[model samples]
Structure formats: structure tokens, C-alpha cells
Target: MMEIRMILGLFLMITAASGWNVTFESPTVTVHMHETLSVAFTAIVTEADVANGTVVVSTTRESVASVDDLPVLDSSTVNDLVWSSNLVVSGNFLGNADILLSIVSPDQENKTSDALSVIVIREERIIDTLFTVFVAVMVSIMYINFGAAMDWPLCKRTLKRPIGPTIGFVCQFVWMPLLSYGIGLVLFPDDPELRLGMFFAGVSPAGGASNIWTVILGGNLNLSVTMTTISTLAAFGMMPLWIFTLGSTIFNSANLGVPYSRIAMFAVGLVIPLGIGFLIQKKLPRVSRILVRILKPLCSLLIIAIIVFAIITNLYLFQLFSWRIIVAGIGLPWLGYLFGYLLALVLRQPGPDITAISVETGVQNTGISIFLLRFSLPQPAADLTTIAPVSVAIMTPIPLTILWIVKLIMDRRKKSIAASAEKLQGSTEPIPTVSASTKTDNTENP
Candidate 1:
């Protein structure tokens, strides 16, 4: 123990005696992908140290940024015991990494300088802009289909009952935002950008995907559609309200400005298509029915397109996904489902209403969140903040898929059993029954 302590003390003395310091012109540098940047740095050392030591600049994450010059500093670059060298850094990917300066010495001991932070951004291509526009246009068109599917009289009756939609509304706005905030606090306490992303996703309206999930999961399709419409219409106010109030704290922490105009535009976009759909539904019932028939497949296509385009356009973001981010992703929607379900169950909502509310609460309109982030924030941050929303969007459909599969298997088994029973009885009369689970509740009221 004594020898170990003495050796440790000697090593510390040697380290303290090796006086070498490297300082950069800037502590941090932001570069666009495929661009090269020369980072100027100065090192203070003795003549002998410079002669014996080789200065190497490298990045902690080579995938994010690569150092161009291998040996950035050496004796040749040094003058009068002081050396100033340029480390050429090239952005290879879109993310953050640390640039390290090190002095390797065989005669003495090696020393490494403090990290220089690098932020790499991917420039938005024309295709990216076009893709965003495409998403917006497609979503608006899908809302027309949404509108065609709405039964105004049934909507009015559902409103009269008001239990399911009311619960959905509260869950979507109240519980979701608060839950996301809490999750961000717990999971990513130091990352204000991620917290803001989660908050933005939380406050956004219910997605059209929720209605599709409801249809597949044998939920109240009427309630799901009605809630989706109501929540979207409400986003014009609710989103802004949340963003200005509690969301303001996160925005301030992240040094982000709330884009009030863009949000209002998003709400307006939803309303216009929906209004046209309603007109078509009421005036041209036949056309509305035709659109309604195609609505499911069209919505599925839209969902696929959104996910595929988002992934393709921001392929770099997948690299940013960490365990904490993944947990935040999975937790947000699943917790929303739990909260919505428990709330409705506590209120004695019928089974179908419970499913509808749960689906509505869990599935957020991440399109709005992504759109707002991309348009509102500048490059890099626009991409960075998107991680949270994209994560949630990707994770949101997983459980629904599993549930749908299980439900399909169970439904098939039940049908098979019914067929066997009919065969056993040797009856020619066919069984008058509904085999599929996608039935709407006869009573909209609790």
C-alpha cells in the first residue's frame, strides 16, 4: 500500500511538472456536413517538449466530424516555444462531437487537452423542402377524407353524450403535456431541447393515425374520429396556450422562440380541408361515401409516406437515438395510453370509449411537431429538436401493431370455433353474427 501510494504520488508530481496547455481560438465550432473548417489552436510548451512531442488533433466521434491534418502541430510548426496550428475539421455527419488535441511523447508522458465541441449540420436539400411541402399537402388532403367520414348528426349526438371526447380532450392536452414534461425531467434533465421537443409533441393534436388504430383495434371509430377533429380544431388555441405558458419555460431554457404564426397556420390548414370534407359529405353524399371507402387505405398510405420520407430526409437523426431518448420515446405514448385508459375507466366509460380515448391520447400529431420545429428553428437545432418527436412518432405505432395482430388471431380462432359448431350441428342455416371486431357502439352515450 505504501509503495502504491508513493508511485501514485510520483506519477501525480510528474503530471504536474509536465506543464502543457492547448487553447483554441473558439471553444466550439459549428460546421455543415461536407464542409471543411480550419480551427486555430495554440499550444504553450518548452523547446524540448515540442521537439519530442507530436501534436495530433482527432475527434471523439469520427462519424460526426473527421480531422483532415494528421499531425497538426510539431517542432516545425512551433516558434520560440509557442506553436499555433490550424486543425482542419470536416463535417461528416449531422450531430455533436468533441475535437481532441493530444501530445504524444515517448521520452516524457503524454498529455491531452480539453475537448473542443463540434456541431455538424446537414444542409437542407431541395428534396427536403419538397418533402415537407408534400407532407403538408398530403395531410391536408387526408383531412378531407377525415371530413368525409364524419357523420355530423352522430357527432352532435356524441357531443351531447360528451364523456369520451371530453376525456380524450383532457388526456390529449392536459395529461400528455404534463406527462411529457415529467418524462423529460426524469429522462433528460440536462437536455432542454429534448424536453422542448417532447413538450411540443405532447401539446400537438391527436393524429389521424389514432382513428386508424381504433378501427383496427375494435374501438369506437366514431369517438376516435370525432375526438381527432375536435382536438385538431382545439389546437389553434390549446397549442399556443401550452407553448406560451409551461412550454415557455422549456423554450427559454433551450433558447428557442415560439413560432405563433406557424402554429396558427397549421391549425388553419387542418380546418380548411376538414370544412371542405364536411361540405362534400353533406352536399354530395355519394362522393363522400366513395372518399370514405378509400379513406382507410389512403390514410395508411399517408402514414407510410410520412414515416418513410421523414426517415429518408433525416437519416442522420437515427444515429442520435440513445437509450434515454428511446425510453422517452416509448414511455411518452404508452404512458399517455395508460393515463387515458385509467381516466376513462374511472369515469365508467364503455369499453369502446376507453379504447378510443386511449388511442387518441397516445397517438400525437408528430407531423405538426416536426413541421413546427423545422420551420421555426434554424439548422442543426431544427434537426436536433426533431429527435424527440421523431422518436415518439416511430414508437407510437409499435404497440398498436402488436395489438392488431393479437386481435386478428383471436378473431380468427373465434370464427373457426363457430364454423366447427355449425358443422357439428349439421345445420344448413348460416350463423347470423358479426365476425369482425370493428363495430361501432350503438349507444354513443356512457
Candidate 2:
């Protein structure tokens, strides 16, 4: 009985927090221009004492649309349907518009329902199962590999700088979380799943895989490992906090179920493989090198597979992503890279720490994002929002790969020049002098 009451109280809090106003049967009504659609509104007569003496309907903007008939209260419903109203958005509107219904009583009592947004445009099919599956598989493999790739010895870096972890924590918790929500609002405003996805993605720890990139990019691997460890360890508390904070403050949907089980599973996923990898590294360094080399390439292939399978699964949608999503994909990593470098510079960080932070900031574990999207959210929400993290994953490795290739090429050239100079010096021949005609003016020719 006590547990039941507690559950009931929690339910009540959720209901109260879910934005209750004059109840509309549907908060969103879509109709084409010059077409008509009816919306039903209701109120509780006992609680609100709501009545309908006259009905007035108004659109948010002038000359765009109109509504008709305020609903009346129904006493028949003991606990529900205390009152009702009917309104219509006339086909006069062509763009998105909001509508409000006003019920005025004989005693001069006026009650208004919350604004019901009428989308004045046609809606289309948004997602397919094939694309969603491709996304899930791709992200899952990468995360699994991240766990398996861990070398315990390689995981910790000796850092001369004391505050790198703190700086990374601030950026992960503060800058990125806010940026993610703002980005979500702009790119996928109508998608609640996306809002949740972006928020969680931001709050999630720096990717373990980023340490791989930091080593390649000439960043401080020790700093990278330390920051990654710090951020990831901190995630248990930080993720839920950001999710609830961002959700309640922005979307008014604190009632969205937090996937505590999934979060626990994710934590397990991170720890176990890394723990196993550490054992292998300690016992068999030779085996560890071979495994890391193999895992690195395998992870790269997984990234490519994600893109290829995504494109093949829904070729039409892949090519037809709205401009906003495309920009989001390419732009997010770029922002992380830029801001991270600048912040590190301000902190007077060593070169390795700067590179590590920049990469870590840009690279998030898509696995965590995918896990939340797959299990935490309901259908269609998961499918639609998976794109955000997939985008992050896709962009994360690209710049690093390009930079690595460039570094290799430059190193090869430097080595070639050094080798040629050495060969010339060891030729055991007299050194070549200036040509006789060219040097006559400046040299004493013997």
C-alpha cells in the first residue's frame, strides 16, 4: 500500500508536469489551405467550473485561419469529460498557425484552452525500419570495439598539467550540453526524441575511442586517457541531471521515462571490455599490440559500413535529408574541434592535452546515444533522433584520418631528405664546389 501510494504520487507529479491546460483532444491539428478540420476541447466543470455561454475561436495570426464552437462541460463524466468544446481551423491558412478557443459563461466567466498549434501544411512519412536498423547495428559495433580496444597500460597517461581533467569536465558538462540543446532546437524542433538525443549525447562522457585519435593526432595520450576516464566516470550522475534539467526546462516533458536500466547496461558495457582488455595488456603486451592494430582497422571498416548500409537501406532518405540535419552532421564536430582547441589554448595546455581535448570534445560514443535512442525512447522517436549521433560518429574520424594521412606523408618526405643528405656525405668523394664561372666574382679560385 505504501509503495502503491508512492507510485501514485509519482504519477500525479508526472501528470502535473506534463503541461496541463484547458484540455484539447489533440494539441496539434493539421489541415490544408481552404480545408476544414474540427478540434474538440474539454474542461472539468467541478474543478474549473468551466461552462460555455458563447464560443469564440481565433487564430494566432490575422487573415490566416479561424476556429468555430467552444465546447461545453459534461456533468455525466464523474472523473473525466467534465466539459467539452469543438473548434475548427478553416482552410484559409497556408502556413503553420496557432489557435485558441475561448468559452464565455452567462455569469461573465471566461476560460481559455491552451493554444493548439495547427500545422497548415501537409505532413509526410518520416522514417523507415531499414534505415533505423542500419543505424543501430553500426553504432553498436563501434562501441563494442571501443570496449575491446582498451589497453589498461595505454589507458592512463602521465600528465604534467593538473587542471586538464577539470577543464574537460567543464566543457563536457557546460558548453557541450547547452550547445547540443540549442542545436537540437534549431535542427529538429518538432522531434522530441531528437531533443532528448542531443541532450544526452552532450552530457555523455568523452568517447574512449578518442584516445586512439589523440595518439595519432600527436595529442597528449596521457591527458587524453585521464580526461576520458574523468568524464566517463562522472557520467553516472551528470547524464541524468542534464537530461532532467534540459527536458523540464525546455520541453516541459520531465515525465519522459528515464532509462535507468539501459544506463546501467551502458555502464556495464563500458567497464567490462575495458577491464578485460586491461588484463590482456598486462599479461600479454605482444598480443595487445596485434589486437590494437587489428581493432583499429576493424573500427574504421565499421564506420564505413554504417554509412554504406545507411545509404543502401534508404537511398532516397539518405540523399534527401533536410538541409538542417546535413549542416548539423558536418558542423557539430567542427564546432567541438574549434572550441576545444581555443579553450585549451586559453588554459595554456601542452600540445598533447590540446589535441586530446579537441578530439575528445568532437568524438562522442555513438553507442551511448544509440542505446538511449533504441531503448529509452519509444518507436519512431528513436528512429528519427538516431541521425544526430550517427552524424557525430560519421564526422569524428574524418578529420583525424585526414590529418594522420598528411602526417605520414610529411614524415616520409622528411626521412627521405635526411637519408639523401646522409648518403651524399658518406660518398667518400670531394664535396662539390661552386661552378668556376659563377663563383669568379666572389671566390679565390685556386
Candidate 3:
């Protein structure tokens, strides 16, 4: 019979000032989806607490927690509130969410609640599970199609080439993740989810489009395919390991709700499609080519649709940011590009190898990133987490697309010039050679 709000509580503390002190009389709260919940707390103010103050509340994720019946503060007293599901989480949220409570003064001085955590538990939704499974299946097919176009002969040829994969693996697994972590510190030092989001972006495998871009950019297709395979396979081991390792260091171990098991399952799942593609290539080249042609366009359409769906569903989260996070958000991918290309160049690799490694390094598996972020983590975080990868997904392709276009133009111009020169030579008339007798007669006449 009252207002409903969605609550995702990820606590962010605004450290206390010498002023007023506020504490939750009851440190922990538990609530359910439909029923109402209540919380009790007390606050005290002294002359030392100089400024007017209000309670600050936030969920761990992007959205604010939905609390109803908030009490008015008097310098020293107990207050109570009955919480109802907010419009956002009214029927959708599940899991234990930590609700951050802080007192914000006029001057921005604040104090955090010593203890407050909300654990909202719900059963798994069948619809959500089905949708996730559908997406996983689609991803498998997309990778299979990706593998179909792979130049196997070239893959074998480059299999022994140590330099290219060395450069690529270093950039993909080592450099980008480290850079993402650093940027997360600079930009979202206070926000664990944002920082973790960046870390995941770094750890995501190179997308299907990386191989596509490599071919378009006149890079070695063999190396591109090889790198994608290696990284995809490596992700099974690395993604979960990185999530566990980085989760502890970057955020207080409490804040990170990493679905390590889910990540491992998904990473391992990729091998199925990869092996299928290998079989197709080995058994029937003609069918593989047809599947590649068909799947390429189809997979692209599916990817675009999925991206659009994710953005639209979580558009509100993206709106709640200043240009600071946006720049920090978008900056990660560009940094990957600059650093990857430079790393490859520094290794003294050939031009084609450099281009292939650079593209593979910069372009992450945005589809998988979006999917995992959406389904793996709890809500609000999932929505907020997609921002960096979505930005990367949109921005990373521009350079490769432009390079491909420029290469096409240059190739056409070269062909035109060569044809022109050939035509001119063919059209030229040879100078008539003067016979010896004719030359002698002409000299005598003169």
C-alpha cells in the first residue's frame, strides 16, 4: 500500500569527523522481497559535532537501498525505519547486500555505522537461469564460427613462433590487467565494484572480433587465431584465479561477491565450441566455410542485440556518474591499445605480428564480459560493472576499422597505378630505327 524501491547495498564509508557521532543500535538487518522490514538506530550530537548532519545510505551496487519510514534526527535519540522493497528491487534482488550507513554533515564531515549488513536471500529464478544458459549456448556457437575461419595451416606455422604469442600473452594477461588495476585505483579508489569491474575487463578474453580485425588489418591470421585460442583456454585457469587473487587485494575481501565457480564453468565451457570448430575444419573445409560465412553475420547481429539489451536494461546506472568515472572508464581500453602496440614494437616483432597482437590485446570479449557481469555478480553491480567493457566494446573497434579502411584504399590505389603504367607502356609507339644506308644518304644530301 506504499512506495516500493529496489535496494542494493554496497557500503562506502565517509570517515568520521570530530563532530556528531551516529551508530546503528542494531548492527545487522535482514529483509525479504515482499514483506516489510524494520531497522533501529541511535545518534548523539555534542558541541564537537558542529555542523547540521543527515544520514547517508547506499547499496554496494549502483542503486540506493530502498528504506521507508526514515526517522528525523534530534541531537540525541533513537530512530526507527520500516523498509519496503524499492521500485528497483521490489521483486528482483537476492543475496546478502551490505548496506553502508554514514552521517553526512554540511561540511561533508561524516561517520560510518560500526555495524550494519542486510542479507536478502531468494531462490533462483528459472527464467534467469534459462536466459543465461541460452546466452552461453550462443557464445559457444559464435566461438565455433570464429574457429571455423581460422587459418589452421597458418596456426600450425605460427605455433612454433615464440615471439608473437609471447608478446600477446604478456599484454593480454599481464599488462592490461595491471593497467586496469592501476586505473581503478586512480579513478574509483573508493568504489570496490568499479575497480573490480576494471579488473574483470582486463581479464576478459580477446573477442571474436579480434581475429576478424586481424584479418582485416592485414595482420597474420594464424597468430590472431592462435592467440585467441590460447587466451580462451588460459581463461579457464586465469579468470577464477585472478578474481580470487585480485578480489582480496583490491577490495576488502568482504565487498567482493565473486562467482568464481560460475566463471570457471563458463571459461571451461568455451573449449566445447573450440573443439567442435576444430573438428569441422579437419573433417569438412567446405561446410566450415559455409558455417563461417553464415555465423559471422548472424553472430554479429546477436552480439549487437545483446549489447543494446544490456545498455537499455541498465541505462540508469550509467547515468549516475560524473565525467571523472567516464573518462577513467573509457581510458582503460585506449591505454591497452597504446601499451600493447608499444610492447609488441619494443619486442622487435614484425609489423604484421605487432598489429595482430595489438588488436588482440585491446579488444576484449565484450559479449562474455557483459554476460558474466550480468549473471555472475549480484544486481546493480552487474549493471554498473558493464560500463567499462561496454565502453571498450564500442571504442576498441574504431582504430582497427579505420586501419582496415585505409589499407583497402591504399591497396586499390596501388593497383590503379600499376594498371595505368602497364597501359601506357603498351600504348607507346616505338621510335623507328633509321637504317644505316638511309642515314648515309641523308648525310651526303646535307
Query: Candidate 1 or 2, higher lDDT?
Result: 1
lDDT tens readout by residue for model 2, 285-399:
7876776667656655655565555445334334325677666766667787778888988989888788887887877756566655665654334444566666666667778
* Local distance difference test scores for all models: 0.80, 0.62, 0.66
Candidate 3 or 2, higher TM-score: 3
Report how far residue 335 has shifted in candidate 2, in Å.
1.9
Candidate 1 lDDT, 200-300, residue by residue in tens = 88888888778889988989988987898789778878988898799878877766677777666766767889899989999999999999888867876
Q: Residue 265 of candidate 3: its Cα lDDT?
A: 72
For model 1, the stretches where C-alpha displacement exceeds 4 angstroms are 1-29, 40-87, 95-118, 275-286, 422-446
Estimate, for each residue in 123-236, the C-alpha lDDT of model 3 and write its tens digit. 346654655666677777787876676665666777787789878888888887788888878887776667767777788887767777777888877788788877877777
- Worst 10-residue lDDT window, candidate 3: 1-10
Off by over 4 Å in 3: 1-134, 146-153, 251-254, 275-289, 292-302, 412-435, 441-446
Which candidate should be chosen as best, given TM-score against the real structure? 1
Ranking by TM-score: 1, 3, 2
